[model samples]
Target: MMNKSSQESRVETISEQLSLFALNLKLEQIPISVCAQAKLHMLDAIGIGIASSHYDFAKNILHALMSLQESNDQHYQVLGVPNKLSMRDAILVNGTYIHGLDFDDTHAAGVIHASSSAMAALLSVGQRHNINGQDGLVAYLVAIEVASRIASAANGGFHEKGFHPTGLVGIFGATVLVGRIMKLTAGELTNALGISLSMASGVMEFLEGGAWTKRMHPGWAASSAVTACAMAKNGFIGPRNTFEGRYGLFNSHIDSSNLASLEKCTNGLGQIWEMQNISLKPYPACHYNHAFVDAAVTLRQENAFEIDDIKSIKARISEKQVPVVCEPQASKRIPKNSYEAQFSIHFVIATSLIKGKFTLNELENDTIFDPQILALCQKIEYEIDPKSAFPEFYSGEIEIQLKSGKSLIHREQMNRGSSANPLAKHEVLEKFYSNVERVMSHTAAKKFTEDFLNLEHEKSFINIMNQLKVN
Candidate 1:
């Protein structure tokens, strides 16, 4: 058996290996497919960020956060907002906006919203430093890889322990992204992750009250990571065994940690790209509802059942998703607020069936509690699927019983926007146009879309940020 000291070394060595990958990975070495996917995920994040900025919670958070910033013309843009703030403040505000809708891309295997933190850091820092598109993508991939691997190693223990993996695990990735942009040496990058350990934190308590704190997790993580990197650059010292120390992440943040899997974090370093596993959302609800959204939409489209004809609706899903989306069934059936409705699998499926689509507008009070949607929600129920391959693939099945005694069922193993089943470019663009047009004139939205699609050709990040704002 390995001694306690040797175990600590093993963890530090893996952390260093991750640091080395971030320090050395090249833009050219990224696969063509991974690059395309990264760009798509990036575009999706930008679109979601701007759309979420229109929310009252996001607006209030932005206002509250900027007030804390010392006024200066350092000039970093917040998505969909015309004004600029200091670099750190901009990263925090925009990062919060990106995840406010809970619509950002996620790595299913790790149950982590990796892009929210990584993309926010990349955009705020990348724009400020005027980093090129390829370089930004490289940084994004590296950071997400490191964070997701660590999350995967934890084997869902973090969430069991009440930590939002996005915030807790994401700080590490955001730190690496900042380090990448700042050209930190491998040693410096290692120290950045080590320093970030002290700043990383987020709890699942937001679920209790439909609180807004969960929306702040990724943004806070991103901002904190930036601070960690800045400190590391100044030669700050941190515990070297940040991942496996007696009081480290796994031991402290995750319940009954998976040391065997955690030990394999560096196994495939540069070879098995984790970037490809990220999934984009088609609906604004919690990702646990994605497959059910598809099933509901299909039930609406394929069958002509009227409200009077439906008897009941039941969803079968991975047991692991119950705590997040289905449990508290009574509360989920009649959500207390819009934010609560977004996490309610019952509300999401009912609305999807009633309206034929689940969009950002579906969460409105008038829509969420529509008499028809509520009536349907009352009839809806969920059952756990013990065979579920959760944290690997999110899949679901919907069963409908008609008053006429006829039964209809729909099942989906691959969600609408997974790599195995992706939205067409035009579909993603349609999403972008819908989101951008909310804040910009039709002409400006179209123009900005074209320009952003060709962002790599632009010489300055200023041009990109300029287009992001309403003209």
Candidate 2:
């Protein structure tokens, strides 16, 4: 049997080797099923980014970035806006907007915000390098694979360790995607991965008090990843064994990362793709709280109980899930900031009960804080169901007692819009149109979405960026 020290060394070596293998693989080798799924994910991410451009937080970030404008070459356009920045800055700002509303896609196993980081890096770098559409799609697929795999390897260790997986693993994804777009060598890719380890950071503190830093985490990773890859290209050397070294990524960040899982990276490399497992978010709240919102929406529709009739609301969820979500004492009415609203199960559930649907607009509105909703929110309580699968899968049960001596109970086993039950293509397009329509007219929005969807066929990234330019 291998000694403990030897085992650790082996694990780190495997991690680095697997990362290089993933980076060197060509896009044409990826399976068709994975490619199709990646396209859907990309569409959804852009749609969400466009929709979020109207959000106060997203607007503030965009406006702040405008002051630090860089020379615009053939780099990607900042979606929904009429400006362009360098590849790194564009990815950072755009990625932040995509996730600012907490409405982007998520993976169950690794808990990484897959699309924001991957798409951000791909669009920005692909445009900068004048990469074709097919090439851009391939870059996105590779990035998603790298990100999701890292998350899977972590296996819920990051959350338990009090780290945000999105920021931690997102950097790897961003670097992988950008390196692919830039056509970096395996050695250069290895150096990029090592450089990224030093920049990866995101804490869960924002979830506690509702801070804007939550959105910034993914953005920062995208920017840092691009910078790391650029540095690697310029002959900057990084620890080759960043993942497996004596004080490498896993050992330092997680309690006990199983490097054996890195084998998953090389297995069925061309045949099976990790991007297929990505799930689109239908609600603009924490993934943990989505099932509760789904359950509550079902109860409201089935019982036909007027909002006034809700006497008491109780949610049955897993024991471990309670602390992260429905902490009874956690303030849930109108949140002080956007990040707070994203994590509060009470606020999300209460809003769903009142409006029958939760959208990006409803979450940001001050009018959402009616006394009736607050009263219902206060009555909300949670119970633990040991059998419920959470973190692994998003599930919840909600029971509401009405004033008429009748109780309505709704249970959700899976979140909607997941791979198990995905949103249709038209729905994705409609979402995009709705978001882009906020800034541009119907004609302009349709033109923009069509251009983006067929980006691979387009001769120039400038073609798309020019459409968004303000007069």
Candidate 3:
């Protein structure tokens, strides 16, 4: 058997090899189904970004970012904003907005915010170069595949190591997408991956403070990736064995690195694609809180329990899943920040039960903390379920005991908006309109939606970019 040092070296070497293989593969080589999924994810991400632009912070970030750049050359357009900026800046701002509301698509295997990094980078670069829809779609696929595969292999290892997977692994995906868009050689792609790995960063501390830092992780990934690819294009040479080096990503970040999984990253690369594994979010909260919300909503509907009738509420979750949520001390009111609302199971469950539906408005509205909601929230209690599957895919069961001595129980096995139960195209459109209607006039939103639906056939990037308005 290899000694510990030697084993570490082997893992790095395998990781680097897989990275190079994936970087060089062609679009035609990728399965058609995977390409289609990439388009779906891209559409979903763009819609979310456009919708989130209405948020105060998103608008502030956009204005601040534009002010910092101060160029009218129009390299790329900011989503929902008429102002155009450099490719890198556009990607950073757009990517941040997409994830700002925590509404982006997720892949459960690695708990990755897949499209925020990849699609954002691709849209920026593709628009700048005026690349066709087919090529743009291909680049998006390459990026998602690279990011999600690395995430799956790295699985909770980064989280366990106190790093957010979306920010760290997201760089790799963004690098691959930008590299593909730039048409880097396999060697150049390897260098870009190396540079990106070195730039990878994001901490879980934001989860504790409910800070806005998490919103910028994907944006930073996109920025770093564009910089890495740009460096490679300028003849900058990076460590070729970045993935498998002695102090490489796998060995350094993950405690039990599986070199074997690296092979799966490149296995059947042209035949099987990882992009299809992504799940859409039906709830605005953390993916961990989805099943709980689902179960609570179901219980409320089934029992016809009026909010006034509930004497006590008990939520049972898996042991592994409880630490991130179940904050008994949380204020029984609308959260102070959007991040707070997303992390609080108490707030999410209460709002869901009282309103019969959880909307983005409810999450942000101060009025959601009415005495009735707070009263209901205080009665809710959480217990760990032995059979719950969590930190993998979110699942939970909730049991409620009412004042009249009656009991109601509900169990949610899988996340509702997953591939297993995906939101139809109509539903996605509805979500987009709900968000856009908050900021844009009905006529403007309709025109924008029509143009976006036909984006795959558009010729000039200017036409699409022109549709965006700051107002």
- TM-score of every model versus the real structure: 0.94, 0.89, 0.88
Question: Where does candidate 2 clash, by residue pair?
Answer: 12-244, 133-456
| Residue 68 accuracy (lDDT) in model 3 | 86
List candidate 1 segments past 4 Å from native. Answer: 1-12, 257-260, 454-457
Per residue, candidate 1 scores C-alpha lDDT tens digits across 45-115 of 88888898788987898788667777665478888877567787788888888999888888888889989
Q: Which ten residues in a row have the lowest lDDT in candidate 1?
A: 6-15
Model 2 regions lying over 4 Å from their true place: 1-23, 69-76, 256-268, 448-451, 454-456, 467-471
Please give, for residues 388-435, the per-residue lDDT of candidate 3 as tens digits.
Answer: 766456787778888899998888877777766677777776776666
Q: State model 2's lDDT.
A: 0.74
Candidate 2 lDDT tens digits, 183-223: 77676778888999899898877766777887878888988
Q: Residue 420 of candidate 2: its Cα lDDT?
A: 71
Q: Judged by lDDT, which candidate is best?
A: 1
Q: How many clashing pairs per prediction, in order? A: 0, 2, 3
Off by over 4 Å in 3: 1-32, 70-74, 256-264, 327-334, 438-462, 469-471
What order do candidates take by TM-score, descending? Answer: 1, 2, 3
Give lDDT: candidate 3, residue 215: 86
Give the whole-model CA lDDT for all candidates, comma-separated: 0.83, 0.74, 0.74
